[model samples]
Target: MSTKILICIDFSPLTPRIVKTGKELAKALNLGVHLVHAQPEKPSAPTAVVHQGADPSLGREMMKEIKELNNLKSDFEEEDIPCSYATPRGKTSDVIAAEAAKVEAPYIVLGSHGNGAMYHLVVGSVAEGVMKKLDTPVILVPAQQRLDREAGR
Candidate 1:
């Protein structure tokens, strides 16, 4: 059976850096990739007599992650690597970890922002929270972020 790999994405420009790393590893190990973006539930705006409808473009723009995922898929295909993508809604950590376990992913790849000591101490790390709850081997792509260093390298 091929190894299953889970990659969490937020459509951040930083996502490709992380996805590329995971794709390389999957190619080396002949694993399948599940690229996902988990959208958190937004609290409903409080009832207001003067309130108007929620902005539609605001939500579609938020789904930039979906576009980024498709772009990554294209990149992976150009490399001749096979991958599948999905978009889910819910808490980021729960959605990622749950899907990973569901697919029996042997590996999970995450990219950090290098927000070292102080930042983690304050806002808390989303990646840290997800890793702590998953049983699969997890990889962190250090925030080297060298994508702009060169393209087609």
Candidate 2:
């Protein structure tokens, strides 16, 4: 089985950078890429009754994520890079780690939004959480630097 690189992406502005970094690493390593988008678990609404398998709003969100993932996969394919994706709904860190483990990925690539310490303290950091949960080496692409560069700082 060929080793793969697991890349976690979100709707953040840093997602493209993360994908690019992962693509470069995968190309260098001659490995396939597995993209993952972890959606937060849906909160229970006691008053809401669902007649369908899943809530319509959640279904729409999932479809949107899948479409984005497909576009990314197509880009990889155009470059002759093998690619696949998963949209797992759950705690972000747990979902990423689980997918990494499932695929036995050699490396996990993700973006660091570079939020301040106070922000991270209250909101928590997905990159930090994934690092803590997995032994696989993680490639953290810093978002702040990119933002600064874009701003001509």
TM-score of each: 0.76, 0.84
Candidate 1: tens digits of C-alpha lDDT, residues 74-99: 88777877777766667777788888
* Ten-residue stretch with the least lDDT total in model 2: 43-52
Full-model lDDT for every candidate = 0.73, 0.86
Q: Where does candidate 1 clash, by residue pair?
A: none
Off by over 4 Å in 1: 1-3, 43-51, 145-153
Q: Per-residue alpha-carbon lDDT of model 2 for 1-153, expressed as tens digits?
A: 456899999978889989999999999999899999886777432223354445657656667778889999999999999998887879999999999998889999998877788999898998778889998999999896767977999
Q: What lDDT is obtained when candidate 1 is compared to the true structure?
A: 0.73
RMSD of each: 5.2, 3.4
Candidate 1 TM-score to native:
0.76
